[model samples]
Target: MSIQSILDIGKSGITAQRLALEVTSENITNVNTPGYSRQTTIFQTSFVTEERGFPLGTGVNVAEIQRAYDDFLQTQLKTEASTTGWSSTVLASMKRAEQLFNEFTADGLGKSMQEFFAAWQDLTANPQGQPERQAVLARAQQVVDQFHRINGYLTDIKREANQSLEGITSDVNESLTRIASLNDQIKLIEIRGARANELRDQRDLLVRQLSEKVGITYLEQTDGTLNVSLSLGPPLVLGNKAAELSLEPDAANNGYYKIFATSPGDNTAVDISSIVGGPNNSQGRMGGTLQVRDSLVNGFLSDLDELASSLATEVNSLHSAGFGLNSSTGLDFFTAPTVTSGYSGIGGIQLAISKTADIAAASVDPVTGGTGNNLNSRAIASVYDKVLATSGGNMTMEAFYNALVGKVGVAVQDAQRSSDLSEGIIKQLDTLRESQSGVSLDEELANLIKYQKAYEGAAKLVNVGTEMLDTILGLIR
Candidate 1:
């Protein structure tokens, strides 16, 4: 080989080795960075010349940097991330609702119901006692207040869950715009015969984050761009452009925010609340939050209204028929509920009678025609045991309320199990992804050492080439 050729080979070798060292250094620098994929330098022969029917090669060329990526694994991770987000969201809201119904609390519905019935029992035993009458009035108000308080708190929880819809959609929109921008950058880089390894990693991380906020279906195009869509329908991103999601107040949902998707070529937006918020849909965090708001918490409120309404109706029926000690008749002991359905079904319930003389504790004596007996008071207290049609037609008001509380507790437990299982699945997928794509400090250090040695060797070749060229020049002179 000519001395000039030796210099050319040494120069290319040094350049290739230097590029390889930089790639290794990048891996080591990003070893702790989240969602970072390890990169390796690719080498190729610069050229080949035929000499005496044999191929003579020049030194190495630095080819494209190869990024470690597995599309199928990443898809699995995104799916699990979506599931984990849904489960955790539902679990947290259910726990808060369960806390409100705790039976040990002094103001809990169960405690109030017990005190209410006990007060009636005392009034039944001493129908003329003013203190027993006053106790019954106090306990009745407590029961009514308990129902109102529980309904209010559950409504608040549902409202909070509804509020999350805005936050989640905002996050989803931000990620979509960022991903489209990266797609633009990635396409530009790849068109120039270079790999955008780091950019691809950032885009993948955004895609995963998007999945956690809302479920999506993604497809990678031949031109290195991602096409993303909602789980149900509506394109979110196409090529380098991203669609947007906006929240508008929905009249049908009592002023709750509804999600709307608008594409680039379309000015009209589509409402996707039912598609995303259906109880059977398992899309992502928004789905879970909607389930809690519209189904779980609202369902508890419905049950609460049922218990309060049934109790008030049954007691009023008995009390209005019996005559009071002062001959007061046809008066409801508790005000009647104005509505038959919804969370406010019990809102109008209160003590209809306030005076101790106003309580209808006496039943007209069968023969004496005197209103001095305790039969009506006993009957009002027994309404707690009467199986009302409002309460599934087989259980008393008390049993029905207790069963409702139990159902809430069970829901919390079930949600916790789902959350735990989803998180565990996500953790396992994360470990697998790290094993395949994550940077390892020990492995990076070893690679760094290897590249450093190669660089030293290339430096030596350059030195040798310089010395040989100097010797040939001296000989010619």
Candidate 2:
């Protein structure tokens, strides 16, 4: 080869090696960086003409630095990761709820109910005893207090869930805005025939993050922009624009929250609460929070009210049929009162008995018109047994409360199981992606050695060319 040609080859080789070295260095530097894709320098030979045909030189040029990635695999990983994230969040919240309602705990409602019933049984054994009457009243008060405490805890949990939803919504909106801005930037870059791969990575990362707060689906538009939506059909981010979501008090209940979406064109409000409440396997933290608020808490409170009502009614029926010793007339030992659904106030029916009933002269069978029987102890004991034997003697109010607590424990266990499974899946997917896209220090080191050798060979070529040229000049001299 001619000296000039050789020089040209050496120069191209040097350039290629330098570029390869730089790429290897970049990979090594980003080895610990999260979500950083390793880069590789693409090389191509320069074409040359021979005597009879085209010839190729040993020189090389860097075509481009390619980022290692598998688009389809990344998409799958992101989707799975999002689902795992949401399930984990909801599981944590549910676990907290379970702990709050633990029936096995010392201060739980189950224990309180049991203690109340046991106290009633003691009082029933000696209905005319002043000490036993006071004990019954005290136990009854404790039962009411326990209900109040449990209801209060449920209210607190609901309130906290609502607050968490609000925070998540704010974060989602921020991410949407960021993604929209990224869309605009990526579109502008793509319009110039440049691939905004880094920007795209950033946008994808944001989408994954937003998905954890509320399940989302996205589509890539023809313009290389993204359109995002919640599990519901409403748009969240469209191309270079984003929609705003706001929380408002539910029409039926001022304390409850309803979700609304804003249109980008004119900022018109659209109610999305029903849509959000629809059946969806893609429900995120927000949906779980709503379920806890509306269904779990509400159901427990309803059950409590039912138990209270039943107790009052049954006791009142027996009490009203028995005659008081102080008077010839019969009086109710317990009064039934009206209860409102979803109401948390403590102003309901109070269990009270006639304090003036002469225990020695009270009649158990007023229907038989008997008097001076002093059967008050037997009458009270019968009422207590009936209360304990309601629902086919299988479930007392105390047992019912215990069952409710057990249900909460089971729910928490189920949530934990789901969360663990989802987390494992996410980890597996992440490991696969990292193996494909993540930088490796050992690979970078090997590339560095190869590039160093190529650089030295190119330098040696240039040196030999210079020496040969100098020798020829000396011969001419």
Best by lDDT: 1
Q: What Cα-based lDDT does every candidate model obtain?
A: 0.83, 0.69
Report lDDT (Cα) of residue 455, candidate 2. 98
Enumerate residue pairs that collide in model 2.
none
Per-model C-alpha RMSD? 2.0, 4.0
Who wins the TM-score comparison?
Answer: 1
Candidate 2 residue 242 Cα shift, in angstroms, is: 1.9
Give candidate 1 regions above 4 Å deviation. Answer: 104-107, 343-346, 365-368, 391-393
